[model samples]
Target: MNYYECMQESINYIENKIYEEIDLNEAADRAFMSLSNYYRLFFAIVGCNVKEYIRLRRIHLAAQELLSNDCSILDTAVKYGFTSADSFSRAFKKATGLLPSIFRKQDRQYMFERVDIMEKYFEIQDLELSEKYPDIKVLKETAPFYGAAFRAESKTPENDAFIGLKAWFDKNEIGNIMPDYRVYGYDIPNSAKDDGTYGYEVVVTIPDDFQVRGEGVVKKHFEGGLYAVTETTVGEIVKAWQRFISWLDISRYEMGAHQCLEEHEVESGFLNRNFEEPENIRINLYMPVVKRNQTEYGKVIVDPVRVAYYREYGSDSEQTAHNVWKVMLNWAEKNKLDCSKCKIYMYNHGFAKVKDFWFEIMITLDFAFQDNLIKEKIFKGGKYLTYDTSLSQLVSSWMKVNQYVSANKIASGNHQWVEVWKLNNWRFPEKGIMIMYPLV
Candidate 1:
């Protein structure tokens, strides 16, 4: 069998005997390698030693059982291959920062999963460089980025924290887009001179209309504006980054209030031991900027849309919107219909923390979709009193706009009052909501 296939078989064997005393001899035998070779290979591709991995996996599984099942501490400990409760407690605390008893009482937002070491071995395609130089581009109202986040404690290149993220993505089948999707490395350094020793998040961008389901996952928008950009070949990333910083220093533009962005391409050459030739890798660095002579967000005139809508009632508008979109998308997928070209929208009708609120989520479908469950309506458009608002002040903002309309004696139209969402998450303080009051 090929090395990749051997690795897959080894992973399977480890998983099957996760709760048992996993023998190193048998694991190496599955990979068709000696014990030392197996250790080297595992550390290189999986990012951790085999024995450490086994312990980490056992602790992770134990966490799941403790959270979901009603078993005693000793029962859980012995069931997960631990000899004694004292040893299990110590190991669990070391693996995750939580004691088992305390972990059982809380609903953990995120958990680590088993790694699928196959991703690192796959064939990596080359990313063509347009040209190597100091380049700057102005991005206006770019789409929000959605992905998983994690903490990196140190600057050690061999740190295995990101392996869990890759494994989680693999388990969810979210890494299907290999070549097109770019993995981002976020580093908010205290001054750009810090040597990669900051808290980092390794994230993959979620595509539009794609479903994402996980905890600690968030949708964040990079403020649309001017940005200073630079590119570097894979092997000379450090030098390229330093040069980019120098370029920024000499540039006329000032830095905007956003974090640094790293776009990584060519997985084979990216900071891994599998491939050492840095010449094969390419990375794009983007830093948000404000022009010496600034700019502003321009006004947009939106036309009416005919949509099939779904309503979700709750206090949490963001969660309701997500749930409603899933229901609508699932319906479309179930009927074998294409929503690729369709525009999805959500309208917040109310937000009552103590009581139920209504959220009307909708999407425009072609005449081809004639489902009985979906109701259709046209959003009448005309001159509107447009104002930007957010989830926290949505109701208050609407009331103020209504008073303005009434005070001005502008007659109201018999159409649905529209609140177009500017950001994916309505909870975003800025650039979240655009309220449009229909006028006769």
Candidate 2:
């Protein structure tokens, strides 16, 4: 059997033996590889060692049972592969940093399943062969967005700035006026020399008549223009931004130089709402789009050579990931890489095994490519595709790519292909999966 087939067999073995004691030697034999070689290959290819992977899988299965079954912690632990509650607790704590009891107390509302499933199938595609361009119509009329925003230095999305904005809105009762205010991010034009730091604005829109006491603050108009808007519901607000960046990469329309905006359309009425309901909250990301143009509005930049996928444990996990991204960005800057050109993308998968949850974050770095030779080298094994998708059909568009690659029996190579997140701005989130193919 081929290496890919062996990998698939290994995954199947793990899934089947999750409720029982897993034997690595037996599994390796089943896959026709020596135990040592299997362990090495698994770690090298899957980013996790064999025993750790099995434990994670078991924990993942246990979590599902804890949510779906009526068994107690000890019983549940035994039903899975845990030796005892103590062993389970230690393992669980190591994986998720939360005790089983505490996790249970918070209830089963903590899982993000859809995002994980979407991510798993979206990253593999043969874009170079199936280049179907999107039929984008430049929006003649602009849509309306209402939210509260303020100016703050671009750090992480979970910086004190957001908390400060929330506090300011709550203090001034501005949220009462708009009722559903969201924090919107805008990139400042012609501010590249300042590391793109001076060029970003973190603002939210409110009603035109909303009162403000801050100096140098004004109600900016959202010019009605064409926008490519898509809606996604995320367990954390930060992942919403990651989803937006991923969509931008896969979409056909090139980003325009107009202001981008986000609208928080709260389904819960304007008062006393449950904060845990993922369905009641909807985030709409609007990116200005125009037909492909010769005059490039901005260049894409990537820096800081390291990349990893992270999964946030809960509501605060998003902020935690954001802060980590900021630190990485700062490190990249200190290393002489441009920060403004770098984008920290977050990919949220609703069905991957992360800790005891199904959410994982994929982070990538994009570097500046001045010479055509360098750009070609960077995208050396990258695949290109033109996707034809409507606003509502966006998720399915990615699935199409996955299906295409699987059907063609293409093998994933050593390195992932660089995906151009935005045709205009060169933006990519610090999370999510990207597919790359061999260049002819």
State each candidate's clash count.
Answer: 2, 33
lDDT of 1 by residue, 229-305 (tens): 55555456677656654444444444454445666542442224243343545556666555443522223445776
Best prediction by lDDT: 1
Scanning candidate 1 in windows of ten residues, the lowest lDDT window is 122-131
- For model 1, how big is the CA root-mean-square deviation? 23.5
Candidate 2 Cα misplacement greater than 4 A, ranges: 1-140, 144-148, 154-157, 180-183, 186-201, 215-218, 232-252, 263-282, 291-440
